[model samples]
Target chain A: MFNEYLTHIPFYEELTQPQKDLLAQNLAEQKLSAGQIVSSDSTSCKGFVLVMEGQLSVSMISQDGREAELFTLTKKEMCIFSASCLFLPSTFHVQITALTDSRILVIPSPIIAKLRENNIHVELFAYKTMTARFANVMAATEEILFVPVEKRLAKYLAAAQSPIKITQEELARKLGTAREVISRLLSSLRREGIIKTQRGEIRVLDAKKLELKM
Target chain B: MFNEYLTHIPFYEELTQPQKDLLAQNLAEQKLSAGQIVSSDSTSCKGFVLVMEGQLSVSMISQDGREAELFTLTKKEMCIFSASCLFLPSTFHVQITALTDSRILVIPSPIIAKLRENNIHVELFAYKTMTARFANVMAATEEILFVPVEKRLAKYLAAAQSPIKITQEELARKLGTAREVISRLLSSLRREGIIKTQRGEIRVLDAKKLELKM
Candidate 1:
């Protein structure tokens, strides 16, 4: 019955029948509410989790309470933070929150261990997925260092949906800058007729003009 | 004969004799002079490499040619940039340079793939090493975003050998800022009798006072 859920997994088909049966039975399904914390640095992961639906944001908070988004996971994406304990004995320590109501599939660490022992491809899949996250993290480093906040803001607005539903503080955290900095830039854009700012949402007024900033 | 080189690797003991023999026979030893380019994004690495002696700096250059160090490798340290192609089909693209005369051991990608096929521990080592690098890069992100240049400057001075052999321009690049920023900070430090600067190096004169800045 649960085998249906495994169908969406990239590595699921590589498993032999016994391996598949073992994993199917051990896989756990979980549902999360929007804004609920999924995982963080403190709670060591017990299983490997894959996002089945909706969105998840992965971030790290500083000792003084500043937040920085590391990456995000969408439909059919695997959250390495949950499965990081498999590759590492210690916690990977990223804070994961359900950005929207989300559904997830989890496989117990023991089951993954058994599968990895029997199949090289299964192990390779883990390595591949881990490296994929590394790519995103590295790209974020490049963006944070090389790209200016103004250009990043323009890019963010350009990529986002109309009337983006995020508070100034949240947006600031995403771009790794002070809220005041983003507020100043957003105000500048508002004056230029590039974007409209409401209480917590932003509406793009000129997408073409925004591209110039990027 | 080359089997002696494998002894320093963290995962070598986990391999069976046949696995070790296969790796040893395939191992290639190479020497590099100071300032030699070990690898770069353009050169897709031919093999997994290990630094047997001397130092290697891993850095990424901006499109405008500003350089930033990602991490460094010394004795017994594995160069993941060389082996990244195995985990990823494309180049990982970090520039590697020999900081001094160095000795490196290389095992062709085919050998690593063959070993990974048979040994989960060997494959796990790759995953572990890759994740370890991820940790450093992420810490760098955190530092670059949150730590002030003054604090970073102080910390850099605190860690290095006396008479640090780096120009202000190079130091600015290392700290992810303009050369003038580092120059201004160094001048202030010089006035405080904390350090003395030469044409290309700065000698630490007051280590205790530098700690206060950090």
Candidate 2:
């Protein structure tokens, strides 16, 4: 299972066989059922979650009593919000919930923090992962505030085109808008034949029109 | 001068006197002139810049002649963007400019990285600072994208405060809007007695109305 997990990450391709073995020894595997709460906003964040098999949704409760879906995680992706658990007052900013029966490698934050010392490659990788995550969140926030709602929806469709299909409600939560508003906009887009949705999954029919909308 | 720098940072307040002195000795002071690019987009970003004596503007330029001012740094504030420089490709995401003749302490990033290994407090401080900065930038980006231009302008004013003294160009850059649009809005606000400006200084005559506008 650990070796299979290694296949999911890009870093493994570059590592020597011995290095991979070392990482495998450091890691432990755990299985989570669908709907499992990986981390809660009130709980201490101990370590990041690497999805070996399954999916997870990152969410937060807004002041309006709405559960906003920030993003989704699937195989090969690691969740770094657990790094927050290393600091005192380890309240998680977002909650991670398993969207499917999942197998994950829960590497303790202390061990990861230890690896950061004298391990330039791991440290750099962690830095890149965290920085990219923050940048994406910031960009999404900017898109929601400055750009038109239609454009924001279009961009979301462009970026999240795989795995756990996104619904209108999910899109609304991610965009920090109301479901009714997103439903209305989706209706308008449907009329214009810009996108098509089956079940909960949305498929973009016209990337060019979406770009134009942006 | 070193003590002056240490006193300004909230995280360093808990440090013993000798610890502060030791850290201070390693920092190198540099002076920059107005309009000078202190750190470019491609240059290796080394050392955290401790603004000791003047103001600086952090900005990113788009290919379309659009410039976005991330924020201005005063004596007590530190550059959050530089966190990337310490580990990643060592290049700055934004160009930092000395808006005024400024004296700054350039504490080498490598040294800080080394210190983190031995000092848990410093590591904690670094983590908090980076996380908070990322959160602020993400929030600001969300505000800019989802909120109306008027609300964004109001937010910028609320952030800078009255008498609002920043140039229309600066305000426009910060709000991601055209200078003409900002100028027109400011003119309307001036007409409504919401704000008053003399020379380069602005005073909010009625902050209450501005909140409503926001």
Candidate 3:
């Protein structure tokens, strides 16, 4: 399973045989059910997580018990937020949960850090992913603080190339708004003939009109 | 100036003399007045920024012309969002502006990359800062998404040990809320004897009450 997981990453071809062997020797497989919390004991987080199947959400839970999701990962996706423990080991600020029944391969910290030190491809892959995700998260912050929900919803719809396969709950989580707010906005969009909402999917009917909202 | 800047960071002692010389050789300095945009040509952003003096803010400007601040740096701070260009190397997303008359040291991308490759301390510094800032930005997102403005204001107030030397405009930017809202909240806190607001400073008078709000 670990070898199979290794092959799925973009850096596999760029890694040395010893690097591959190092990973294969250390990688552990974790199976999670839907809604399972994976941040306990900080064990799973003291390394890197490579998602092999299903979706996982990395989020922050505030003092009031409200969850603010950072990003989600599916197959072939890696979460370096897991390795955040080694950096700020005393504090556990990030949470990971199985959004669906999932399998993941976790490589302990020292090996990943070692690979990053010597392997150009691994380094690039890690930094590229880290910076991009961080920027996206900040962009999400800007959008929530500055952009109105209507414009945000419209822009989201306009940006989609096909019928958006999303639950209202997921959309609410993505937009950092409540499900009722998303339901109301979808109803409004439906009334305007701008989008067609079916079970767990939103199809844009008039992209031009949706763009206008943005 | 670059050598002077290097000594301020915790990792300076860990860097070799050659690493120090390389940084000093490549580092460039810039002087800017308050409100000058430093993110142009992406020139200032092509490397690492070491804040020698004054404060700089890294923010995201949305399509609608509103600013959402990501973080701010005072003395001894560095902004790596500039190096972000080397990775994405295409899109421009973050903006850095001088919030006060400021001087900063810049080390171009190639050299910084080289240093990070060989210097464990430099590598750790870069990743540590990147991950910490990214987490803070995501936490700010969580605050905006789930935290009420009043509670956020209270938390902000309670966290201050001395008189906060910030203007309403700066505080508004930091919290990603409207200046008027901060004004109103401050006034309410003042009226309730929970705090005292002077011309450009907020002095917390009742810590216990302020903590209660949080």
| Model 1 ranges off by over 4 Å | A11-22, A89-92, A110-123, A147-214, B9-22, B89-91, B110-123, B147-172, B177-214
lDDT of 3 at B27: 77
TM-score of 3: 0.68
TM-score of chain A of 3: 0.64
RMSD of each: 5.5, 9.1, 6.5
- Give the alpha carbon lDDT tens digit for every residue of B100-201 in model 3: 999988778898788877875566566556756776766556656667778888888777766889999888767656566688789999999988888999
Query: Per-residue lDDT of A43-139 in model 3, one digit per residue for the tens?
Result: 5446778888899998877666677677899988888777765444333367788899998888888887888778856665665466567767765
Cand. 1 Cα-lDDT = 0.79
The window of 10 residues in a row where model 2 chain A has the poorest summed lDDT is A84-93
TM-score, every prediction: 0.74, 0.54, 0.68
Residue-wise C-alpha lDDT for candidate 1, range A26-64, written one tens digit per residue: 888889999988776665465677888899998865656
- Per-residue CA lDDT of model 1 for B1-214, tens digit only, reads 6666778777789889998878878888999999988776666456677888899998865566555678888888887677666675442356788999999998887888888888877777787677777766776676676677799999999999998999987897677665656877999999999999999999999999999999
Model 2 residue runs over 4 Å out of place are A1-36, A65-71, A88-92, A107-129, A139-214, B1-29, B33-37, B42-47, B59-61, B65-72, B76-86, B89-92, B107-129, B139-214
Interface RMSD (one decimal) of model 3: 5.2
Residue A105's lDDT within candidate 2 is 89
- Quote the lDDT for A161 in model 2: 58
